[model samples]
Target chain A: MTFVIMFLEFFKTGLFAIGGGLATLPFLYDMAAKYPWFNEAILSDMIAISESTPGPIGINMATYAGYHVGSQYFGIPGGIFGAILTTTALVLPSLIVILIIAKFLERFKTNQFVKDAFYGLRPAVTALIAYAGYQVVAESLFRFSTFFETMQIGDLFVWNAIILFIVLMVLSRVFKKIHPAAWIGIAAVVGILLKF
Target chain B: MRLLWDLFFTFFRIGGLTFGGGYAMLPMLQNELVEKRKWTTEEELLDYYAVGQCTPGIIAVNTATFVGQKIKGFWGAVFATAGVVFPSLVIISIIAGFIQNFSHLEWVQHAFAGIRVAVAVLVVNAVLKLWKSGIKDILGIIIFIVTFVVSAVFSLSPVFVVIAAILVGILAGQVKRRTKK
Candidate 1:
């Protein structure tokens, strides 16, 4: 059951997350809401981990989500199996669609309906990515549960982390084209140095 | 046999190097596929990016599939797809092992905190870049705002929001055509 559900959810995500991996963020948040297998925090962790690691972001996330969820129900083997199943299901749509398009992209490339659909979709995807970014920052910089429970500013925010965020933002503006991996490495080192 | 290996090796290296996401693979694709291997031209690469964007899966995988099929048909597509995702699967599996063991440690916890903040910044920059590429004019802006608010709202399902955006886009496109006439 875990395997089937994992396969199906990711298959749907693969189908509908049209723009790219970041575009998949909304669907993932919904999945966290819908399933008890994982929660919002883990989802953020997945995004961070997925962003840092190699391979495709969407595929890495689906694999991580599937493994974590499946392990709870079955075992480690079940988790690994679920990961394999999910990765396959997630890419199946692209394989089919790309094959079809490779054959006839010439005709469809200039299609009006396609153009309009994409035009509208591009902005929407941008918005979705923005929403995703907001979620990531919120998770990174604040302790929401603590804030809600205590209703105090000190409880609500982690000033040290917030400082790191602002400093990173400044560095980003200065070195606009440095590889993201380098930035991630520097942050990890600083986090260790500061003892977080 | 060698052709499949070539496809796999090329994409495997590509899959390993790209950090940000599918879009980050663009220059690497240009260098390897066109300048290095002659698998695709610059124009064809752009076409793949555009088509890949609107397609139903990860853009990088879709682009790989397109390039693979063009080179060696269905099997070529398989090899390329496998290659691109192969490194991620391997590396992430190892990370999963370490994370399970060390996630609760003091230093690991702190490092992740820093990494998360850095990732947040990266995502913000990505949004800004997307803005320059995709959002222009009033209609695009309207679509962006509506989609952002609706999807960001906890109560609203993102599925409906995406569907609404597509429908409105099609309508707006049709109206713009009529106005031009």
Candidate 2:
């Protein structure tokens, strides 16, 4: 039952997550809120790992989410199964839609409805992704749970996270040639070295 | 059989090597598909990419499917897609299985914390890029602002937000056509 729901959820993500892999972030955020499979902290980790890994970010995230959800319910074997199911579910819609488009490539490309719909969707998808980014930044840099407990101003921020975030953001702009995976690798080493 | 196998291996190589996302995969696709094997011309590949972008789901997967269907029909599309996603399924599953065991470690926790910050930064960078490309006119800006506030402040489902945007977009397009006449 859980696996079935997982498949449906991922299929929906695959169906609607237009634009690219990053576009899928909003859906993943929604899943984190709705399911016990993952949380914001884990979703952050998933994003890091997915971005650094091979293959597409959207598919990697689906597999990762599937594994986490399945493992919690059934164990390692379940995780592997979940990974396959979720990945397939995510890819299934693309396969169907692309095949259909391939047959009518010319007609579809010139269709005004497709163009206009995408025009509106592009901005909305960007906004959705931006919101997802905000949630991630908050999860990483703010001590929300701790703040709730302590109810103090000092307790509300993860100062190290904030500093690192700013530094990395600047470095990313300055060194535009570097791959994101490299920056992530640098951060991991810095984390260990600084005991962050 | 040979062409199907070639299609699968070609995409598998492309998928395993390329990092970041669909755009990052382009130079590689040009090299492998257009330049090396002559499976497609540069123009056709670009068209596939453009169509893939506006379509739902991952762009890379959509491109692979389009190319495969063009080459060897349905089975080609199947194999290519399967090959492309195979590496992710294997690599991520193994990592997922192992990472949970080590997640409780102090050093691992620290590393993840740092990675988390970097992830946020990367996501913000992506949003900026999207903004430049996606937000074009007044309608686009309005849609962006409304979608962001609705989802961010009110915490509405992104699905609803996306659905509403599509409807509004089509309606706006129709309205513009009528006014121009």
Candidate 3:
């Protein structure tokens, strides 16, 4: 049952996540809401792990989610099976789509509608990507209790996140040539050094 | 056999080291895959990137898979996917083991605070690059704005938004055809 559920969830992820890994966030959020297996906090952790690790963020998250849910519901075999199910299901749609697209690429290279549709789809993709970023901010920075608090204009702000955001942005701009890995590495070290 | 192993190891190293996801992997991929190994040309890498974006799956994995397939057929994709995933599986397993405690650490949270901002910037850079590459004309601009506003404001499902855009695009094409006739 867990295997089947994992397969179906990832199949949907593959079929509909048009823009790629980042695009899968919204779906994962929805999944969190729908399934009792994981919650938003775990999803956020998944995002962090997925971002820091290799492979597609979506695949890693799916694998993580499968492992968590399957292990909890069934056992070790269930977790492994769930991971396999999600990975195969997640890539299956792309495999099929790419094969079909590959076959017709030459014929459709100059097709105006195909070109235009893709062109139009680009912005939508951008928007989806932006929304993913925003969701991350909302989750990390804003809290429901803060919202409910006496509408204190000053209390509404999360100064720590905002400050860190500004500092990182400045560092990125100032050290434009430095690889992002360096920054992430530094941050991780800082995390450990500061005992965060 | 060595070549396949090299390919696998190279990608595994890439997958292990890269943080901030696919876009962050771009320069590293170019450096390792194109510059060092000469596995594929720059133009081919760009083409792979484009295809990776349009298709499903993570761009990094899609790219690794495509490159792997190009280099060694089915086994290439298999190896590349494994290479890309191996690091995360190991790291995440370790992290997962200690994550319950790790989350409560103040410095860890602070570091995440900084990392989160970096992630935002990376996403912004990605968005800007995509916008430049993608939005070319008036119709393209309209589609972008419409999609952005609709999704950002209303929080609609991207699948539905994409479907609608395709429908509108096809309709526009048909209208143009009729007018030309």
The digit string of per-residue lDDT tens for model 2 on A26-103 reads 998999899887899987877766655667888988898888888887898888888999999999998999989888
lDDT of each residue in A83-146, candidate 1, tens digit only: 7778888999889989988877546768888677667767776776677678888988999999
Candidate 1 regions exceeding 4 Å error are: A1-90, A101-105, B1-80, B92-102, B154-157
What is the Cα-based lDDT of residue A142 in candidate 2? 96
Better of 1 and 2 by TM-score: 1
lDDT digits (tens) for residues A1-89 of candidate 3 = 65677688889998888766788889889989998867999888777666545556777777777667666766766666556566667
What are the runs in model 2 whose C-alpha is more than 4 Å off?
A: A1-90, A101-106, B1-80, B92-100
Q: What is the interface RMSD of candidate 2, in Å?
A: 6.0
Model 3 clash pairs? A195-B107, A196-B105, A196-B106, A196-B107, A196-B108
Return the top candidate by lDDT.
2
Stretches off by above 4 angstroms in model 3 are A1-58, A61-93, A137-148, A189-196, B1-76, B95-106, B171-181
Clashes of each: 0, 0, 5
Model 2, span B46-161: residue lDDT tens: 45654665678887899899888988999999999998898888888888877653345677667767776776787787667556667888998999899888886785655577
DockQ for the candidate 2 complex? 0.43
The model with the greater lDDT, 1 or 3, is 1
- RMSD per candidate (Å) reads 6.6, 7.5, 5.9
Would you give me the overall lDDT of model 1? 0.77
